[model samples]
Target: MIVSDLWRYPVKSLRGEPLREAEVRPWGISGDRRWMVVDPSGEKLWAGEHHDMVTVSAARTGQGLRLRAGGRPDLHVDEPVDGPPVEVRLRGVGHAVSAGDPADAWLSEALGRRVRLVWLADPARRPMSEAHGGRPGDVLSFADAAPLLLATLPSLRQLDDWIAQNGGGAPLEMSRFRPNLVIDGDLPPFAEDTWNEVQAGEVRFRFAEHCDRCAVTTLDPATGRSGKEPIRTLARHRRWDGQVWFGIRVVPLNEGTITVGDPVRAEGTRSSR
Candidate 1:
């Protein structure tokens, strides 16, 4: 198998950016989910609950952070905010960081509510889950299950065909799922189900679980518009293990930069044990 695509979300619970190459870190890709939006009470916000204008895309510019929406001009933050420290959680992991007032103001105006932007640099941080056996260097993420998600081209095509038969307009692009790595092999749907270890370049990842479908998939990553086709199509044909499975979650066993076209080798199968 070969890698066909890669992505990163600079801010948790927002639109993601496609990357040609990226530096891998213990928690995840550098800058991936390093920032997040939260309420005045330090509660983190997510696309799944609040489908407001706050689902804007963000990126790191030479100066600082830049944000843009469908019709809004880009907002930039060159200086960090000064505020009382607060703890934010990704899944269940907690991180103590400061929130910038400018970010809060921008987000408040965009969503027509009060909110703030928090960074993940405080040493008091802890990952959200203990089930995966959080490692010393591992960073817990807001991802549905694992720190990384992997999908195969053939499986996506199969879903597209199935959607077409169900009268869904077109096959959605892989971006809708926001996977960190998109592999090019012809694997069956849920094929990662049997994989325990996979190697891409020098990075090693352990397949953990299947990512279940969520309402966030209904939102159009392009325009931030919500629809019913993708979720509806998935519900009818993708349900497995009592849940609608869509992607495979993975945790990096070893860290290294994985680029597009990198060869992928599965080390062991579930049945091998």
Candidate 2:
């Protein structure tokens, strides 16, 4: 039971980057989902509705951001060029703040709409999901569940096997799910169903709920193309409760740096009541 892979999506609903080590924050990993694209109405934009483009991968470079895309060259933006203030709804919470402009333009052109980028200042506040026993006022992080989602290699392999048998292509990489962590070791597919606590390195997270699949999963993160195979295959065997869940959501109990290759351990049932 060791940590096999780690990832972070600098922007919401877009391609993510693998990380060797990541700093966990109250909302999520430091750079994970800190920024988002919004329409002219200030409503947030997502890959599900507008799949052509909506994400911009970036890194902190000396107080600036270095960005990259599938076919575009790398872009750099220095400070001083401030973005507009806007409110964005995640899950169901309204996060208000001003953000950087370069990110806004980059995302707007990608989606061919007027969109802006906004950042979260109070990372602890979240948009609670109805699936997670949350109320209108019950704030949640930017994630679907707690703060992170974890999956195992064996579990992914199981899904791949199921997909192949059902005429779906090769099992797509875990990146398609945009999980924060990928663990190794022999575990049943969707074993996260019953986990309550998961330990990785010095960090411990409380497993709270299973992540439901969405149209975003059908879109290719790399090419932004959508298909029905994965969704159709998953529907046959992965449907649970009233929704189709595929990953486990977790809330961090202990905060610390988590790196790849760390042993992963789970305690408790693998099924939800």
lDDT digits (tens) for residues 1-273 of candidate 1? 888888888777777788888777666666677678888777878787877632588886753678776666678875354455676644554544565666778777887778888776631244535564445555554444457777888878888888888777877888777788888876666566577888877788877666777877777776667888577877787775666777677878766898888898876567511
lDDT of 2 by residue, 1-273 (tens): 778888987666766778898877655676777655677676767778888653556665555556677677776755323554566655455655655666667766656777876666556666556567443444344555566777778777888898888777766877778899888887766677778788888788876577788888887766778889567877888886666768787767656888888877899755453
Clash number by candidate, in order = 4, 10
- What lDDT score belongs to each candidate, Candidate 1 first? 0.71, 0.70
Task: Give the CA lDDT, 0 to 100, for residue 123 in model 1.
Answer: 19
TM-score of 1: 0.87
Instruction: Please report, as a residue range, the 10-residue window in candidate 2 with the lowest summed lDDT.
Output: 133-142
Off by over 4 Å in 2: 54-56, 60-64, 77-84, 90-95, 127-141, 270-273
